[model samples]
Target: MKKQQSQWTHREKSFSAFVTGPLLSFWRQRQERQFVGKEGVVIRYMRMTAAAHKKAILVVPGRSESYIKYPEVVWDLFNCGYDVFVIDHRGQGLSGRLLDDSQLGHVAQFSDYVDDLETLCELELSGSRYHQTFVLAHSMGGAIATLLSQRHPSLFTATALVAPMFGIVLPMPEWVVERILNWTATRPHLREGFAFGTGRWHATPFGINNLTHSRVRYQRNLRFYADQPELQLGGPTTHWVREAIFTGRYIESIAPELHHPVLLLQASEDQVVDNQAQDRFSLARNLAGFPCYGDHPQVMEGARHEILFEKDEIRAEALQKITEYFLTFNPNTV
Candidate 1:
């Protein structure tokens, strides 16, 4: 547990030196602004460790996520001697919001995420003093990273996915529901507007409760949200869900094209995304005609979708596998 030397000003509290302590202090330390893309979308990002390091990792968060949500993970990477860069994707956190006139939280395609990623890699990595670069993506970010790795095979040294939302374990039949929604949306676009899930403005204890393996971590996350109410990005819009289904299906169709060495971290008890699909995809890739694209699959038992936010020991083990794999198979280093 490394003590954070800088006092955080956001929530009027000092952060604990331990890796899994309160998040307000960490969030306060990372409230700086950085520009991304030609439009200067003002993506909020935080960098850990100023000393030039040999390797760097760009962390992408899940849907409707803010950079403040993952300070512990960033700190872990920093302590491991890797310079870390984390950004809030467009329409989330402090990045550019969808136009007021348009549907709130609407992202028409995942390719938009790819564009953002490409800009960050070109602008940040190209100018950085680090020697090697990799991507660690979670959930929706995992899908984006997979697609990006395939499209720009030479850009990243490797990619690590934590509970990648390749597909979801929906309570309802996914294909049937998706087809029905898509069909309904075709006739009257304006009439098709519906909020995703229960469109509640406040964070649900149930949602945050199920996120971590330890009560301490869950409580810490809750306290941060208590201070910064704006950090709570409720549910996805109907349009956003529709877009996600479309993007997810499209990405699934293109998995065979990915050429980078990928490390897929699947949680045994993941509730949000389909664990079975993750395992299936990994095994299918190994059996698929393209042997180069799939080989490394690491499963962390007794973990949830938020694997990095789990108890300290579990999180450490998961990260160790990632670090080891990247260090071993990184194309840029080898």
Candidate 2:
């Protein structure tokens, strides 16, 4: 069979509305599938195929992101001779929502995301023609990927974490934040406010947004949510904040045991996750004379939290580095 080709390129001078538009006629559209996650929650996913490629890239998106937001990314990978798989985690995107208010972001525990991802892999990826698998995770998804790596050491050949959430950069002190989270999580009916005073189901104007430097890319994403209100979600809940804190600490404990080659891509101007935490994890071996576990850290200067949504020059470089990292480890790469 011949490989499917895409007309998309990362070298575009600006994000093309034609490419990122709702129609998506030029790109191969992914058929949505559902899997039963832990406790019978339904998780939604989409897989894009490259008929002749034997390698696959599994993309795990961050909070409030759905597979629809990543058509350009999927097209880019498919054109580079790899299959692409992306999913909307439970309680976000098209997946099942936890709270009665679908717009409210909520998760009782972070491990539920891990369970959902494992189910997707078993149902879709096991024993497939794509022999080697790589992961490209962003933000919170990066945390999920790291936890998966610690638990299943041999699952992925290599991984790239873009602006991984090792630690969240909150305004208050860590102790005070933890205290508030603990109290709110334990409270039965007193916790419904959005974290950091962000309102429910609200959109920020491009001028005040800190997500990405590219107005074109930012507007494109906003358009997606505007068209499909169901896919849009707001700030994290108290339970979610508590669970994430626990998961972050767990990852730190097992960081020394992770043997997989990981590329930790840190954004220099990231206002979401703590850059100092990423630095500590990346340089743990050098600083403490501990055994190295292939933690390679690369910084994207002047980029914000969402490096993938930044200006074309920055996005291009980041994608190139990610593609190179995966290709280097996949023996089938030509």
Candidate 3:
């Protein structure tokens, strides 16, 4: 497929002040709507108006994330002259919860996520005016995006995965944890307990939290959850853990088959996802004895798992690199 004209530009930094300001009023002006996902679950999504001649970028958030948590990122893309679309995945955010306890994170199958994403794209994005589409996914959403990009090779022009959860760091060995969760996931009685007895419904204080090193951004998230308790989600259920393990392994296995232009961003000091697995996935250059395209891997030294929510300097650096990479390939030109 031939590429189209380049619409990328050196947009100035205009979202510098959004992190500390009130975002509800700003986001209320963005278009919001709802759609029925798998099993008729209601999914909430929003879209930002794009400047003329710009493309669309979809934001796929990680576990326990909500669209409410990404106002700064949305504004950043807006400043970069790209229209942004964001969604609250089914198990978290404003979407319908899976279990009786709304705070418990659970999913019967990981494929449900992939199906929901495909549905969302077909219904919401396929008929849009713009032909070039870009994707920026984080953590668990990165895993989902990896599978989506591979399964539907023509869907996106380019993709950037930040702190992707191709493999996760657990206390026990990966196989051991997977076996335990697999056992628990099948039994109806063991599905309600928190995975590893962590990730409660309430927000952890910033003094002891490891999500981000930036106090300002960390406290801002805490305040968001405090004002909107319904958006607060707790630990994952055994089923959720089991599903994630299987999904991560699957994504790793298919990493070499993906055909899209990819930039895999790694957080050098991350304690969440397995960085070794990320390295292996990024290095895959062969499939079925045939040479394949390898991903462009970049490491952000000293950054934590939440690169977008990190310190001002680190976040700025990551976004700058991401913008530069995406500008190299115009979907219309490809």
lDDT of candidates 1 onward, in order: 0.68, 0.78, 0.77
Candidate 3 Cα lDDT to native: 0.77
RMSD values, in order shown: 5.3, 3.3, 4.8
Model 3 residue runs over 4 Å out of place are 1-25, 51-53, 286-296, 331-334
Which ten residues in a row are the worst by lDDT in model 2? 1-10
Candidate 2 has which clashing residue pairs, if any? none
Which regions of candidate 2 fall more than 4 Å away from where they truly are?
A: 1-14, 20-23, 285-296
Worst lDDT run of 10 residues, candidate 3, spans 1-10
TM-score for all predictions?
Answer: 0.82, 0.91, 0.89
What is the per-residue lDDT of model 1 for residues 91-187, given as tens digits with 9 covering 90 to 100? 7766776545322454655677777877777767885477778899999899888778777888887788898987766557877767766765655
Flag clash pairs in model 3. 2-334, 3-332, 3-333, 3-334, 4-332, 4-333, 199-235
- What's the C-alpha lDDT at position 241 in model 1? 67
lDDT of 3 by residue, 1-334 (tens): 0111111121113223443344555676788878898898888888887558357888999999998898878877766778898888998998888888888887778778888888878866797677678889999899888788878888988888899988888889887887787688667878766888576677688877767877777877788788998898998888788777778778778766766777878898898888898877776634433222233358888799999888766787788777767777752431
Better of 1 and 2 by TM-score: 2
**Candidate with the larger lDDT of 2 and 3:** 2
**Candidate 3 steric clashes:** 7
